[model samples]
Target: MRKRYLITFGIVLFILVIDQVIKFWIKTSFAFDDPSVPLIGEWLQLNFVENQGMAFGTQLGGGMWGKLTLSIFRVVMIGAIIYYILKQIKKPDVKLEFLIVSAMVLAGAAGNLFDSMFYDFIFRDYFDPCISYNQVEGSGIFSECSYFGYTEMVEVRHRGFLFGNVVDMFQFNVIWPSWVPWLGGGQVFPAIWNVADFAISCGMILVLLRQKIYFPKEKTSKE
Candidate 1:
């Protein structure tokens, strides 16, 4: 049990730290909606964008209440997953893989939760300022900088508390054939995401890909 706890918590902390580092870099170094800088010659790019709603930059509803609801939902889901993992870990034959996946999920959720809950008070927009508000402040580590041609142009209106925006910065410029459905000759997987989002997706995808192994069926006595 001690070993399991250490491994699980370690994974979560490692992911959370690295995810925050990347997000902090993005928030302070680049301008908003700036042209995607090619990391792998158009294949992979770093495009900074803030998601105000769900993963992959999908919006749920408009206004503060909508965002509040989304944040609450995330909190509940994270709590449920953590509770389930804790209970399962107490079992003698708990699956290590499942535990790792759960840890990853928990880390990802917590990472995004941090942004949703406190980023507004910790960081300010460098390229774009709040159009509606006259002024705002940032107290984060990289809250001020001049790298990558970044200028403290406009401070975005502070959303406050559980209304902060999720920072995302990875973009894959996937080229597809002209015959390929709606993606014809356009970038595939265009949704810009962050390290935390990637971690969550990876964990969930692994579970789906190996569901049979993680969840085995019991044999009947008659059989």
Candidate 2:
């Protein structure tokens, strides 16, 4: 039991630390809506933005209440995950893959939760308050810019709990040619996300890709 928990904690802690560290770096180093700094030409770029709502910058509803509801929902989900993990740990035949996948999901959710819970307290929002979700107004990646960390002139007025923005940095600007379907040479996969989002996405993908392996069907008593 101790070993199982240790492994679980190790995975969650490791992911949380890395996710927060990178986000911290991006948050402190660059401004919100900063131009895309290509790491691999235009294919992969570092574009900083903050998500005040759901994953991948999607808005949950409208105002502060919507944000709070989303944050609470995430906490509920995290609690459910913890309960599931604990129950599984007591089972003798629990699969390691399931545990790993759950850990990934937990870590990712916690990472983003931290941002929603406390980032507003720590960092000042330079973005125009009227511009909700930083919704893109124009075409192409160059149209956006990120705010560097808070300046002396800026005041850090934290939002009432669980109302901060989830910082996103990584971008894959895969613009297909004009002939390509709806893309029209525009960016494919336009959403910008962070490490936490990646972990959750990867974990879900693993479970989907290996559902049978992770959760094989049991033989019937008659058989």
Candidate 2 regions with alpha-carbon error over 4 angstroms: 124-158
> Which 10 consecutive positions of candidate 1 have the poorest summed lDDT?
132-141
Model 1 whole-model lDDT (C-alpha atoms): 0.79
> lDDT tens digits, residues 126-195, model 2?
4454334533322122222345753322222226579778899898988878998886978888998988
113: Cα error in model 1, Å: 1.0
| RMSD, candidate 1, Å | 6.4
Q: Residues 51-155, candidate 1, lDDT per residue (tens digit)?
A: 777778776664566678889999999899889989988988778988899899899989998989988778744424432222233412123334478655434
If scored against the real structure, what TM-score would every candidate get?
A: 0.84, 0.83
- What overall lDDT goes with each candidate model? 0.79, 0.79
